[model samples]
Target: MLSNTDIAELLARQAERESGILSRAFRRAARSAFLWPEEVANVIAQNRSLTELRAIGPFIERQIRHWIDKPPHSTHRAPTIRRDFVSLAKARQLLARKPAWAKILRGDLQMHTRWSDGSGTIAEMADAATDRSYEYIAITDHSKGLKIAGGIDEQALKKQGNEIGKLNAFLRKSGRNLLVLRSVEMNLNRRGEGDMSPESLLALDLVLGSFHSSLRIVEDQTNRYLAALRNPHIQILGHPRGRIYNFRIGLSADWPRVFAEATSLNKAMEVDCYPDRQDLNIDLLKIAREHGTHISLGTDAHHPWQLEFIELGLAAALKAKLPADRIVNFMPIGELKSWVREVRGRAPRRP
Candidate 1:
């Protein structure tokens, strides 16, 4: 139960951490603006902050990080719209050719091969993503909770780590830039906690928290996520909500508070690439953006082809008007490593 004053205090402390451009513009815009989108837009367009604007304009709330008017689907012709000042068609064309294995950054990258769900072995997944240019791939296997899906418990996890070591050795023999990260996809259980215990979670390179069940309880949903964040071992909260099509979670809890807590603790939230279960809806995403929360866009990828969700996520992020740097996917390898280390305090990672 966070008080309004608490929220204000937290926000104020964070304001100091904001960049100079943001601080000035927001201050200027906060004053004298009426509640009008056009006026708000005018202030931003003219480089004025709400505090220094002509009027305290209408507080424009974004349901997403930004808005996206996607190109209409075209069968015979290419689709087009404007995204970040670039013609949508041009961006799409540029991306359409990127190898499916391609990733935005390199290093600390690991992927799965045929040994698990996708089409390769530890070494093979690394080679493919490397071919497309990625630095690291976290080879997170399903945990014991997902029995039907080859979930691994302590024994399985240790084995995976050992195997990753071998892969690293093989890669080093040839002087390749790659690292196999040992990780897991944890499930958000009935108790609001994720699948594995905090102690177990701490051992992995990264743990993706997801709501595999108990998603209907909308009232306590945000609290559930907050509790998960309190656990230092959980590095990334995956698909905060468990909303699958035809069965949406119907937006629950105080997202502002949730994002605030996560950002304060330096935890990462997921922007799952699974369209079928677009759990953390646009509105929540907007909250993350406004709160300056760090977001991780995952494909919730069950197969190799699913990794392509990165491009699709770009469309969503563009629509939200979110800055690319705000996303973990767009982060450089070192920054990504640093943030993960900060959250888990587990580093000098094993070779």
Candidate 2:
């Protein structure tokens, strides 16, 4: 039987062989394969219409059914850009085998709201987190540097904080356990420098710095990783590789040295769980494990529903055999805050 992974590969290869709108449809279906909650084969077995799946229409569905009816004799391993991504169905299977691993997770470390380009409001995101029993969730909206994403300025950051404060107060009064953290997905230059002001970042519960430019560089970026970790304002390096599925290959770095620097500095590296951008994937997480580096799981959620993406990152950490204590999301809210404080304390004092 062809797994979703197999089906996805076939679709991607089919895309390469086609042209125009047909090729775009195949490519889209391939990417959506990761988010499909059930295997296409299983959906077929249930006598359900394949159109129920995201990005699948009659044509794409028929193509996928043909592949399911006749499994390929041999499917080549995916290229680097498409490799190592865990489908939601596969991630769910992994977590099902080890239910306790996911139970330990207390919160999500990154998300966006209407303060930036996200579709949901802060309250909506909070309500969704509450549904998931999350104790906290960070609102890491884009900073002013990423103007393309409706990034917020420092004044806007403060105003967003005010709304968060009111929401937290209401949650407290209503006896909800959830806390919305004030944060920004600060854009980083190729030199691994952040775009937001130090004063602006100081008000946040935590900060996530990420590279948004020069991601296509073919050079080794060990120094870039080092510089980002050394950045006093950032506690987590978001999507360290800046890779996207079937798109950019992202930057390269001396893995061991990067993990070691992050470890020594008490900084955390993120497993960005966006379906198309599961950066710091299982392979790198294993290297980080060897160094006992801190691992943070963030859905990079743009909408409330995307919170479910956490499973992909959670399963990756479990496969990597990362120590539970080293994964910050497993920490209770108070302990999670303390870890951020400790990480901040260790940053070099700026002038």
Which stretches of candidate 1 lie above 4 Å from their native place? Answer: 1-120, 197-200, 218-220, 247-251, 345-351
Task: Point out where model 2 deviates above 4 Å.
Answer: none
Tens-place lDDT per residue, model 2, 1-351, is 888888888999999999999999999999999999988888999999999999999999888888888888878899988998889999999999999899999899989888899999999999999999999999999999899999999999999999999999999999999999998999988778888889889899999999888899998989988988888889999999999999999999999999999999989999999999998899999999999999999999999999999999999999999999899888888898898899888877887
What is the Å distance of residue 20 in model 2 from its true position? 1.2
Per-prediction TM-score: 0.64, 0.98
Clashes of 1: 41
Instruction: Compose the digit string of candidate 1's lDDT tens values, residues 1-351.
Output: 221112222223333456686544333322111112233334445766534423222331220001112221321211111001222222244445653322443432223344445555666667755664656677766677866666667776777778888888988798887666777776657554656665566667777765566666646566677887776567777767666432344436778999999888777777665544444556667888898887776655555644544444454555565666667756766777777777776423434
**Reference-based lDDT, each prediction:** 0.55, 0.93
RMSD of 1: 16.9
Best by lDDT: 2
